[model samples]
Each structure stands twice: as C-alpha cells, then as structure tokens.
Target: MAVTDLNPSDNDQSFRCTGALTIGRAGSTQRELDAMPDGMTIDLAGVDRMDTVGAWLIHRTQRDRGAHIVGESAAVKALLEQVAAADHPVQVRPDLRPAPTRALAELGTWTVEVGQTLFGLLGFFGATLVGFGNVIRRPKRFRMNAVVSSFDAVGVRALGIIGLMSFLIGVVIGQQGAVQLQQFGAEVYTINLIGRLTVRELGPLMTAIMVAGRSGSAFAAQIGTMKITEEIDAMRTIGVSPVEALVVPRMLATVLMMPLLSFFSMLTAIIGGGVFCWVSLKITPATYAMRISEVVPLHDLDVGLIKSLVFGFIIALGGCFQGMLVEGNSEEVGRRTTNAVVQSIFMVIVLDAVFAVFFSSIGWL
Candidate 1:
C-alpha cells in the first residue's frame, strides 16, 4: 500500500491511495486517514482491490472528515455505494414497557389463542361425529380389533393403579372424617361420609384424572407421532378415514371403560374405608357393609356413573384433538401430549361443576 499527497493546502488538500486496500492494513490505513484534515479529496484510482472492510473504513473517514471520494473503477464504485447504502441507525437495547401494559397485552394474546384453540377443538369434534355417523351407517367399517386393543390398553392395564389410588384416597378420607367426627362424638357417621363421598364424587373424579394423565397422554403421543410420520396422510391415500380407524375406536373404548372403572374404584374405596374402620374404630366388616348399604343412596352411584361417562368422552376428545393438530417435528408430539392431559383434566373439572349445578337444579343432588 502507498499514500502520496497530490495537492496540499490548509483547505481542500488531496491524497492518492494505492495498492490493495483491505482488512490487512485497515488499522494503519484508518490511522493515516485520521491524521489528514477534513474536506479533503480521496483518490482511489490506484486501488487494485477494495473489499467490504476497506469500503467501510473509507466510508467512515469520508463521513467523519467530510472527505470527497473520486476517481474509482466501476466495481469499486459499486462496492462503496453498497457499503454506504447499508449505513443506518439501529436500535440495540430491548424495548421496555410498563408492567400493567405488558400484562394486559399478554392477557389479550392469551385470550385470542384460547378462542382459536376452542374453535379448532369444536371443529375436530364435529369431524369425529361425522366419522361416527359414517361407521354407524356402515357397521362393517367399524374397527373392532382396534377397539379391543384400546380396551386392553386403556382399561385392563389401568386397573391396578386405579384401585391402589382409590384405596389410598379412601383411607385418607376415612381417617380424616373420623378425626373430625370424633370431635363431636359422631364417629359412627364416618361410614356415611366415606360411602357418600366415594360414590358421588371422589371415585369417578380420581379415575378420570388418572386416565387423563395416563391414557389421554398416550393417545395424543401415539396419534401425534403418526401425524408427524405422515401415517395419517398414508391412511387417507389408501381411502381410510383416520377418525374412524384411529379416534373412534379409542374413544369408544374409553367411554365403555369409564363406568366399569368408576364402579371398581368405588367398591375398592368403600372396602378401604371399611378396613380402616375395622382396625381403628373397632367396627367389624359386617357392620361397615350394613351401614354403607343403608346410608349410601342408589342415586349417588348413578351420579358417579354419569360423570364418568362424560369425563371419558372429554378425555378422549381432548387427546385425539390435540393429536390431530400435531405438525412439524417430533417435539410437537411431546407438546401435544401434555396439552391433551391438561385440557382433558381441565374440561372434566369444568363439566363436573356444570353437572353438579344441573343435577342440583333437577333435585338429583
């Protein structure tokens, strides 16, 4: 590289820059340029090669010192123009907003997302009903094998855990109810408390929660993987309805199993409460059974069965809906699976409240 003064004066001085003007000599070149006064002429006619770094340095010197660039080839002129065009102010710091404003914006976004999801779920449910209708019209299209497989998976495999959970919950309820009743010398009514609570609420509710966490997540993960793998698309290509082949069978299995599981949960819970009474309250099994039969109404059992059926429907709907919505990579399978469980459990609780209000209004409570 070489620099020579062409015409020197207190104002309007000129200098010629030659050789390769690039990153290698950018530091020295910048220092040399800084020594020159502003409003000078920079001659690039002798520059053999000028890259982006060189252009940036020259452009900066020209802007800061009011230097005029002159005498450049086409390529150098274009490169300099591009570098100059790219210069602009850019914001570096993050934009901060007031806390309340940020919170309101987040709330609005959440509300919109929830509305969209709800709309999509409703559409999916309608498609499921259409699939069910088609199967009903053509009985042979029903997949009995898939339904049986789902039954074994969702119902039979779940019995041990459901029973254990129910037993523990019953023991807790019995122990706590006894403690409270003992304060009023009404320990004998512990049977009524346990029997009524188990049959009317806890048994079916707990079973639904367990099913949402277990079978619901499984449904979403399985179907989501299928969606990601394009298996659902393949089914459609082969003239198979995904809803009929995949979703309906699983939903039917869940709906059929819920009432049975709820009943099993109820009996196990009652037995657990009875066991606790026998051990701690000096009550015999025979007396416990007699009291349970006398105090717990048949209507209470009906309430549990009804709730179980609805809960089963909602759980299957949420799982299958989330699964059908899956797209993109394998990570979507995990996200949809979690969404299935959360949506199912949340919907179940909301519907449970609705049912309670409805039943109470109708004098069934």
Candidate 2:
C-alpha cells in the first residue's frame, strides 16, 4: 500500500491512501493515517481493494479527527457505512447497586424461589398420592420388585452405620449424663437420661438425618440421572407412569423400613448405654436393663416410632421431588441431590419439633 499527503493550499490538505486497504496492509496504513492532521480530508478514490478492517480504520480516523472520507468505489462506501453502523458502545461491567437496595433485591429473589419450591413440592405430593391410589385400584400393577430393591438399598445396607453411630452416641450420652448427675449424687438417673433420650428423641432424629445424607441423596441422584437420560420421558411415552414405577416403591420401602431402623437404633443405643453403666458405675447388665425399662415410658416409644414414619415420608418426598425437578445437564443432578438432602433434613427437624409440641399437649410427654 502507498499513502501520499497533498496540500493544494495552506488551508487544504488531503491524505490520499492507495492500493489494497485490507488487513494485510492495515498496520502500515493506520500508521500513515495517524500522522495526518485533524480535520483533514481522507481521499480513498485510489483504493483498489478494501475489507472490513480497512473500513474500520477509515471510520476510526473520521471519528477521532473529524476527517471527511472521500471515496469513489460503491463497495468501499458500503463497507465503511456498514462498519460505522455496527460500531456502538458496549457495557462490559454491571452497574453497582446500593447496599440496602441489593439486599432487598436478594431477599425478594429468595422469597420467590421459596414460594415456587413449595408450590412444586405440593404438586409432587399430590402426584405421589394419586400414584398410590392407582396402585390400590390395581394391585397387579404394583412394583414389588422395586420395593424390595429399595428395602435392601435403604434399610438392610444402612444397618451397620446406623448401629455403630447410635452405639457411640449412647456411650457419650451415658458418660456425660453420669458426670452431671454424679454432682447431685444421683448418677443412677443416668439410666433415665440415656433410655428416655435414646428412645424418645435422639434415636429417630439421628436416623432421619443419616438417611437423608445416605438414601435421600441417592434417591435424588438416581432419579435425576434417569431424567437427564430421558428415561422418565420414555416411560411416559410407553404409557408407564414414572410416579408409579419410580416413586411409589421407594416411598413405601422407606416408610416401612424407617420404623424398623429406628427401633434397631434405639435398641443398639440402649445396649451401649447399659454397657457404659456396667463398666463405669459398677452396675450389672440385668440391673441396667431393668432400670431402662422402668424409666423410659411406653408413650415415649410411640412418639419415636410415629416420628420415624413422618420423617421417612418427608425424606422420600423431598428426594423424589427434587429429582423430578432436575433439568438441562449432569451438573443439575449434583445440585438437586444436595438440595434433596438439605431439604429432607430441614423438614425432618422442623416436623420433629411440631410433633414434640403436639405430643406434649396431648399428655404424651
């Protein structure tokens, strides 16, 4: 490319650019153009070939130095016009908001998310109930195999961990209770503390939390994977109800097995507490058992079993509901799985508190 500057008069200067004004010559051409005085005329009538880069260079010179473009070719003129038209300001960063305004906006967003989740959960619960009704009306359609598999997965396999955890917890409670009660010379009441607390409160609550982490997260991951793979949709296309095939069996298994798990947890914890009493307090195994039976009332056992059933339902419902809500990609499966565990545990704790108040008011305390 060649660039020539001409001055016919002191007040008249023309910067003439010739040859190809394409990307190949852009750097050199731009350097030459940069030396031109402001408000000079840029004459491109001698330009043989031009491209977008050439047009952009011309547009920039015109914008920055108030230079008038004088070109002859229709193609060059169109390219320059197009490049100038396309150029516009773009905001690269978002505007910052005031602290209180941002806080309120975040609160509003959170409130809306909570409301949507609650609405969706209610719909899922209704669908689950309808699935149960369909099974009742057509018992042959029920999935016994799925229920058995779920029982094995959620209950039988979980016994080891639950039993071990409960045993450790019982020992800690027994040791701590004895420490405090010994101060008042009533260390024997440690039996009451261990037995009552294990059977009535800690047993079911701890089991629910563990199950939420283990089986509830599994439920969400399993169903969410099926959703991402379009298996749920394929089932529906084949006239198979996903709720009946996928959800009902898991729900039934969880509800049925929870009571058994809770009972086992209670027994293991009491045995642990009894062992601590036998070892530390010089109490016999028989005496510890007798004291536990006397101190922990029957109503307390009922309270625990009842809470186990509700907690199990909530765990199953939360996991399956969040799983069904999964969309888009595999990353969503992990997110929904975490949500399932958190939602299940939170609901279990909240409902446990409600049950405690209701039972106490009805004289079950």
Candidate 3:
C-alpha cells in the first residue's frame, strides 16, 4: 500500500491508503498511526479494502472519537463502526448501600457458595455409594490394586509419622501430669490421666489429623492434577466412571485402615507414656500396666476407634470433594489441596465434638 502523511501534528493530519489493509501490513499501519498525534482525521476513502486487523488499529489510534473518518465504501464504514462501538465504556451505577448492608450481602453470597459446595459433595458421595454398589454386584470390576495402593499410601507409609507424633504427645501428657500430680502426692494417678486421655481422645484425633495432612492432601493433589490434565475426561470418554475408578477405592481403604492405624497409634503412645512414667516418675512398668488395666475401660478404646472411622470418612470425602472442585490450572490444584487439608481437619474436629456430645448423653464418656 502507498500512504501519504498529511500534517501529522494537527487536527487535519491524516494518511491515504492504496492497498489491502490485512494482517500482512498491520505492523506498518500501526507504526504510521503511532507517529501521528491525537485528534487527527483519518482519510480512508483511498483504502482498497480494510479488514478487522486494520479496523482495530484505526479504532485504537482514534481512542476518544476525535479522529474523523472520510470513508469510501459501505462495508469499510460498517467495519470501522463495529470496531469502534466496542470501545464505549460500560456504565455501572455505584452501590450506595451502608457498610452493614454490604457485609450482609457478601455474607449471603458466601453462604450460597458454601451451600452449593455442600450440595456437590453430597452428590459425589451418592455417586461413590453407587460405585460401591456396582462393585459389589460385579466384584471383578473392583480394583484391588488401587485399594492396596491406597493402603500403602494412607496406612503403611503414614505409620512412622503417626507413631512419632502420638508417642511425643504421650510423653508430654505423662510428664505434665506427673509434675502437676506431684503437688498432691497423687503422682501415681499420672498413668491414669495418660491412659484415659490417649485412649479416649488423643489417639484417634492425632492420627486423623496426621492423615489429613498426608493422605488427604495427596488425594486432592493427585485427582486435581488428573482433572487439570484432562485425564479424568479421558476416563469418562473410555466408559470409566471417575467415582468408581478414582474415589471408591480410596474411601474403602481409608475407612478400613483408619481404625487399624489409630490402634497402632494408641499402642505406640501408651508405650511412650509407659516408658516416660517408668523412668521419669519412678512408676514401674508393671504398676503402669496394672493402673491402665484397672482405670481405662475398653469402652473408651471403642469410642476412639469409632471416632477414627468417622474421621476417615470425613478426610476422604473432604479431599475428594475439594479435588473435584478444581478447575483450569495447577494453581487451582494447589488451592484445592490446601482446602482439602483445612476442611478435613475442621470436619474431624466438629464431628469429634458431636460424637463427644452423643457419647456423653449415652453415658459412654
């Protein structure tokens, strides 16, 4: 195209076009437009043909409707008009409500979001239940390998950390109780305190918290990555239900393993407390053992194990739910993973309180 710049700095400054204004010549046109000042007139009557690329450049340079266009054909004028129309700013009225009203409005929005999330979780839970039913009807369709892998991932691999944490907690409880009871000369009751606390509360709660941090986050991260990569979509396309293929085995494995893991945590914690009491408090191992046998009821152990079972369900549900919520990118995967951990821990504590109330009412506490 041939172009002539006419008085580039003045209102009459303009250029004449003589060739196709296509993407091929967009760069050159942009440079010419840039060299001119604002408030110029655009002489487009000489343009052979202008496309979206050319129109966009014209729209950008004009900015505030200061540039007057003297165009040749109907199509070119229409294109320019279409492009320029989009530049008009949308008008939005201000929200003039008081601060309290806005806060309530925001709270409503957040409540709606939370309700929707819970609804999705309930639907996913039902789907997982259906998946379980399908597997029961056709056992061969169930993936034993995945269940075993989950066992290793959530159970066997987690033993060390859970064991260590529980042991230290027991030691702390034992030592603290010993110190306080020494004042009353009831130092022997230190084992009583440790046994009741560990079996009734600390064992299951600590194990569940540890598992939430480890396995729950893993579930969210793994499933979320699969979603972001479209692998979950691929599973659907191949007639595999993601609920069956991904979530059910995890649910089963967690439910099955949580009690066992918590039992291990219980034993380790008792051992740690027993050792501490024996060495630090002059309480013999035999006396500690006898004291626990006489004081801590089997019902307390049952309560903790039952709590662990419920906590397992909560942790798995929270992780898988957050994972399914993920969309778009790796950033979302990380976000949902964190949500999984936080939600699992929160739900575990809430359910623990509920169970505590129920147990208390039933005379089990």
Residue pairs clashing, model 1: none
What is model 3's C-alpha RMSD? 4.1
**Comparing 2 and 3 on lDDT, the stronger one:** 2
Residue-level lDDT tens digits of model 1 in 318-355? 99999998999989999999999998999999988898
Ranking by TM-score: 2, 1, 3
- Candidate 3 lDDT tens digits, 1-365: 73757763553666677778878899988788777667766778778888898888777766754666676578888898898787666659875899999999999998998898789888988888899999999888899999999999999999999999989989999999999999999998988888999998999999999999999999999999999999999999999989888999998899999999999998889999999998988888888899899999999999999999999998998899899889999999999999899989988999989999999999996
Instruction: Report, for every candidate in turn, its global Cα lDDT versus the true structure.
Output: 0.93, 0.93, 0.88
- Please give, for residues 1-365, the per-residue lDDT of candidate 2 as tens digits: 66667776676778888888899988988888877788989888899899889889999999989999886489888888899899999989989999999999999999999899999999999999999999999999999999999999999999999999999999999999999999999999999999999999999999999999999999999999999999999999999999999999999999999999999999999999889999999889989988888888999999999999999999999999999989999999999999999999999999999998999899997
Per-model TM-score versus the true fold: 0.86, 0.87, 0.83
Model 3 clashing-pair count: 0
Candidate 2: C-alpha lDDT:
0.93
Q: Which candidate is the best by TM-score?
A: 2
Give lDDT for model 1: 0.93
The segments of candidate 3 whose C-alpha lies over 4 angstroms from its true place after superposition are 1-43, 53-71, 89-106, 228-231
